[model samples]
Target: MVMATTASTAAPTSLSSVTLEVADIEAARRFYTAFGVDTHIHLRASGTQSTGFRGFTLALTVAGPATVDSFVGAAVDAGATVLKPAAKSLWGYSGVVRAPDGTIWKIATSAKKDTGPATREIGEVVLLLGVEDVKATKQVYTDRGLTVAKSFGGKYTEFAAGQSSPVKLALYKRRALAKDLGVPVDGTGSHRIVLGGTADAFTDQDGFVWEAAASPAPTPS
Candidate 1:
């Protein structure tokens, strides 16, 4: 059975916020604030570190490196590996590490900026697929007329379906994805699919439900 914790109906039309796990809330707070991310909300408690933005929320709960290591274990067991490990980068981003689930996230402070962008540009959208074999999945998509945009070893691969806008579909090892989503591995694939407008989620292979949409909801629609 697939369970969705939030009421979000679709994969966000545009990239909203990416969450990260941090070891020190105060340090993480200072980093992002310095980076110029508008910190609209901040909470420090025994079990939670949550922040809100205009369109999204980022949560950083207190956990030890072992917890993160355990998460890595879960991901590996599910057939994925750490793309990057938890470390403090000179660039000012700090977090435990990154996983091969098609998204790169970090826990760190925001960089200092003189001006904020009036609007954000849309970037490539990513999808994580759980397939029987990485080679076979890549072949199938390629055979279906999709082109390989990039490949991260045999564990992660991206496909370009040649959409006019910047969008791409990705395939990843399922176990790693389930770990990233903090869910149990049922050996099925994603449940949500994203289109061009009004995002909606649907159940797909292996009862994995995902969210998709054409674009972000209009302001007054």
Candidate 2:
């Protein structure tokens, strides 16, 4: 015999897609295309007012330092303002760039040396939210059925978005994250980001909205 589960008892939700709200869709598309991340990130135009740091950043993890340089250079050429120039840190080599659309992006790699020449390859895309209270926000997501993959006190928490999901989710302290991205901590109005996943639609502790999962694009026949 087998048992069936109800909607209330279903498995935890996983992050499926990330949509960034931009003022100009065409311009954003052009910038992302030049930056070589257009395929991974979704963009939509909105008149929603936003200022300063959007309280979030999308990080791209690549193979090595050379790859990091490649991405940073491309992003800079695409009109992205460099927040933190690519440099070797204790944990890895990384750089931060503010997209023309007002979204902050971080390009990083764990390996200090390149095994080979740089290529236009991205390993992981992580959506990191800057929350006022990490512990409370993490609990809210956990209660909403998101599994925690890594946690460290109230400083940081990362959720397991499953292997097949397009984006990964994580949380960090607002001030700390701002310092890491080389931006001011203060901001107002919309976060200007929408997350799509399997979980029921609802806003999180920091006003980040999650809607129903976005359907995958049709394959070429």
Candidate 3:
């Protein structure tokens, strides 16, 4: 396992924070807080919000469109790959992007027609992948069979295969990704297979760790 020694000199700008909706907000909060991120608990008269200093905001909400578009665009501008351009669907306007750690982000606009605060909602599900080479990883997904939905330099790339369910995947450079996500890179490599999903982690010759996940049907809007 390689310890991340390089710190990102670039301070975050534009993206105020990203919120991840979880089945258990408290569990998510505990996991991330233990990962070295500064956390804040905001309790409103109406509800509560947990914000993480790792440049993301976490909460639970029904998903919506305008929120999806705004969130996806901001992530893309901030070096994330915009997989599927935001568009209207039977469900809503959907978009996909890759986070710094090779996690797939599925963003969808709401299907309901309303102008209220709850009209549009945003959420993200992460997919993990394993790869031998970051450069080759990008190529395998972009070269021939797959389609390049979007690319952010060599750091990240997104591909779409026209699946009925949301399919946005990202390739991450192992060492760099570990530093960004504040996780210790395990040299031995690991593979996790869930009933309907699969994830594996391995290092390339350059010792870059990688993870890939196959998610269930996109979360209900």
- The clash numbers for all candidates, in the given order, read 29, 0, 16
Give the CA lDDT, 0 to 100, for residue 132 in model 2: 86
Q: Model 2 residue 19 lDDT?
A: 86
lDDT (Cα atoms) of all candidates against the true structure: 0.37, 0.84, 0.38
Worst 10 residues of 3 by lDDT: 37-46
Please estimate how well model 1 matches the true structure, expressed as its whole-model Cα lDDT. 0.37
**Tens digits of per-residue lDDT for model 3 on 95-206?**
6555433234445545544355433232432233333355665553333234566667766665553443232344555555444434444434222111121223333333
- Candidate 2 error regions (>4 Å): 1-12, 216-221
Q: Which tens-of-lDDT digit does each residue in 1-221 have in candidate 2?
A: 11122234443477777888988999898899899887776887899998787899999999999999999999999899999999999998999999998899999999999899999999988999999889988887777688999999999999997665777899999999999999999998899998876655777768888777646331111
Query: Of the candidates numbered 1 and 2, which has the greater lDDT value?
Result: 2
Top candidate, metric TM-score:
2
Q: What is the lDDT of candidate 2?
A: 0.84
2 versus 3: better lDDT goes to = 2
TM-score of each: 0.36, 0.91, 0.34
**Which order, best to worst by lDDT?**
2, 3, 1
Highest-scoring model, lDDT:
2
